[model samples]
Target: MKKKFLVMSDSHGQNDLVQEVIDKESPIDGLIHCGDMEEAFGKDLSFPMYFVKGNCDSRRIGKKIPYERIIDVCGYKILICHGHLYHVKYSLQDLINEGISQQVDIICFGHTHIPLITKKKGILLLNPGSLAFPERGYQNSYIVLTFSENGIHYSLKEVMEY
Candidate 1:
C-alpha cells in the first residue's frame, strides 16, 4: 500500500492557511508539522499528526509538546524538530548529528523560513518553510512524502494562495 504525508512548518498562528492546505490535501495518511505553529491546530484532524514545539510557541504549549520527535513511517525513520533548538540558522551540524544518532532516514525542521531539501550523510533534510511568513526571495511552501513499495519520493510544493 502507498502512504502519503503532508509536511509543513512555521504556520505562526495562521490557522486559515493551515486549514486551506489540509482541505486541499485531504486523505493523507499523516501530517507532520516541524513547529512554529503558535497554536494547537491538530485537534480536529482525522489523520495522524506529529508536531514539535518551536521557540516562538508559548510556554504552555511547549509544556505539552516536545522539542523533537522520532516517528516511523513505511519503514523509514523520521526526525521532526523545529530547528531553533539545533541552531539551524547558524548550521545544520547539530541537527545532522542528532539525526545520525537517532538513526533516522530523514530530518524535517523549520526556523529559517527558507524551504530546503537536501541530502547529508545519506539522510534527507527537509524544511517546508513558513506558511504565513516566508523569508525574502522564497515562496510559501511545504513538502509531501510519498511512500510506496518501490521507495520514498518527495516533492516541494508552493502554496497557491487565492
Candidate 2:
C-alpha cells in the first residue's frame, strides 16, 4: 500500500496560491499546511487537511487552533510546525531536538522561506518554503511525501509554471 500527501507552508496571506496548489495536486490522501495561511481555505479543499498556526496567525482565527500537530500515515509519524518557535532561520537544531524528544519519524516546518529536505540523526526534516513569498531566487514550490511498505520517498515540486 502507498499513501501520499501534499505538504506546503508559509502562504502568508495568499490563499490563491494555496488553491492553485490544491488544484494541481488533487486526489491526494491528505494535505498538510505547515502554517501561515490567511483564511479558512481548508473548508474548500476536497481532501482531509492538517493545519497549524503560524506566528502570523492571530488568536482571532480561533482559540482552538494549535501551533503544532502530529500526524500518522502508513505507520510514519510526521510533525508539523511553523518553524518560528524552533528558530529555523539560524539552525535546525531546535527542530531536530523536538523531533528526537517526541520520537517522530519526520519533522515538517516553514519560516525561512527556503525549501529544504534532509535527514538528521535518523530523522527526516522538511521545509517546503513559501508558495506565495519565496525567498529571492527560490522557486515557489511544495513537497510530496509517499509512504510504502518499502520506505518513504519525497519530492519537491515547483508550483510556478514558468
Candidate 3:
C-alpha cells in the first residue's frame, strides 16, 4: 500500500495558517510538523502526526514534543528533527552525519526557513521551509510525500496553491 504524508515546518505560532494547511491537505495518511509549533496548535490534530521540537519552541511546549525521532514507513527509514542540534544554518554536513549514524534513508528538518529537497551522498534531505515566515527568497511552502515499495515521491506546494 502507498502512504501519503503532508509535511510542514516552522509554523511558529500561526494557528490559523496551520489550520488552513490542514484543511487544504485533508485525506492524507499522515502529517509531519518539523517544529516550533505552539502547544495549542498541536493538540487538536485529527491525523497521525510526527512532531519535533524546534529551537524557537516555547518552554511550555518543549517538554511535550520530541527533539528527534525515527519513523518507518513503506520500508523507508525517515529521520525527523528541528535541525538546530546539527547547526543546519551553517551547513548540512552535521545533519548528514546524523542521518548516516542513525542509518536512515531520509532526513527531514527545518530551521533556515528555506524550502529544499536534495540527495546528499545517498540519503534524501528535505526542508519544507516556514509556512508562516519563509526566508531565502522562498515562498511559504510544504511538502506532500508518497511512499511505497518503489521509493519516496515528493512535491513542494505553496501555501497559496492549496
Residue 90 in model 2: shift from native, Å? 0.7
Better of 2 and 3 by TM-score: 2
TM-score rank order: 1, 2, 3
User: lDDT (0-100) at residue 140 of candidate 3?
Assistant: 92
Q: For residues 1-162, could you state the per-residue lDDT of candidate 2 as single tens digits?
A: 987888999887778787888778776888888888856674555567898988888653565778999988888888999999999999999999999999999998998889999999999999998888899989898998888899999999888764
Name model 1 segments beyond 4 Å from true: 60-62
Global local distance difference test of model 1: 0.91
Position 81, candidate 2: lDDT:
95
lDDT of 2 at 54: 86
Is 1 or 2 the stronger prediction by TM-score? 1
> How far in Å is the alpha carbon of 59 misplaced in model 1?
2.3
The TM-scores, one per candidate, come to: 0.96, 0.94, 0.93
For candidate 3, lDDT tens digit of each residue in 1-162? Answer: 888898889988887888888788777898888988755474565568898998888485757678999998878899999999999999999999999999999999998899999999799999999988999688999999988778789999998854
Better of 1 and 3 by lDDT: 1
lDDT of 2 at 145: 83
Give candidates' CA RMSD values in order.
1.1, 1.4, 1.8
Off by over 4 Å in 3: none
